[model samples]
Target: MKRLFYSSAIYTALGLLSGLFYREMSRANNFDGYSQLNVTHTHMLVLGTIMFLVFMLVEKNFSLTRHQKLFNWFFVTYHIGLLLTVAMQMTNGIMTIKGIEVSPAIAGMSGLGHIFLTVAFILFYILLNKSAFKNKK
Candidate 1:
C-alpha cells in the first residue's frame, strides 16, 4: 500500500508537471498546432496518474502484497515505459515544432515503450485475477 501510494503520488506530480510544460510550450510556440508534447501530457495524466490511482484503490481492496514480486515488477516496468514514452514524445514534439525531421530510432523508442506498457498491463491483469479469486470458496 505504501508503494502504491508513493508511486501514485510521483505519477501525479509528473502528470501535473507535464501538463504545465505542454501549456508553456504551446504558448511559446504561439499555439500553432498539436504536437507530440500534447500526447505526452495526456498520457502521463491518464496512464501514469489516473491509472496508478486506480491501482492504489485496487490494492486497498485486493491486498496485492501476496504477490510482492509481481507487483514490484509491474510498478518498475510501468514507470520505465511511461518515462520512455514521455521522453520520446517530448523529443519528437520539439523536433516537429522546430521543423526538424525525426529519426527512425527515436520513433522506435516510443514503440518500445508501448511494448513495455503492454507487458506491464498483462502482469497487472494476472495479479488482479489471482487476487480476485484467492479467497473464493
Candidate 2:
C-alpha cells in the first residue's frame, strides 16, 4: 500500500511537470505543433497519475501484496512503459520543432512501450481476477 501511494504521488508530480513543460514549450515557440507534447501530458495524467491512484484503491480493497511478485511486475512494467513512451514523445516533439527529422528508432521504442503497458495491464487484470475469485469463497 505504501508503495502504491508513493508511486501514485510520484506520478502525480510527474504529470504536473509534464503539463508545465507542454505549456512552457508552446509559449516559447519551441514547437511548431504541440501534439506530441500534448499526448505526453495527457498520458502522464491519465496513465501515470490516475491509473496508479486507482491501483492504490484496488490495493486497499484487494490486498495486492499477497501476490507480491505479480504486483511488483505490474508496477515496474507499467512505469517503464510510461517513461519510455513519454521520453520518446518529448524527444520527437522537440526534434520536430527544431526542424530535425524524428528517428525511426524512437518511434519503434514508443511502440515497444505500448507493448509493455499492454502486458502490464493484462497482469493487472489477472491479479484482479484472482483476488476477486478468491474472495468469493
Pick by TM-score: which candidate is best? 2
Q: Write the per-residue lDDT of candidate 2 for residues 1-137, one digit (tens) a residue.
A: 88777877887888788879878877787555646777787888888878888998888888777898988898899889889999999888777656778889989999999999999999999999888689586
C-alpha RMSD in Å of predicted model 2 compared with the true structure: 1.6
Model 1 vs. true fold: TM: 0.90
Cα lDDT tens digits, model 1, 26-75, are: 78877678789878877887888788889988988997768999888888
lDDT of each: 0.85, 0.84
- Every model: Cα RMSD to truth: 1.6, 1.6
Q: Which candidate number would show the highest lDDT if scored against the true structure? A: 1
Clash-forming residue pairs, model 2? none
Residue runs of model 2 more than 4 Å from their true location after superposition: 30-32, 135-137
Candidate 1 segments exceeding 4 Å error: none
Q: What is the lDDT of residue 92 in candidate 1?
A: 90
Count clashing residue pairs in model 1. Answer: 0
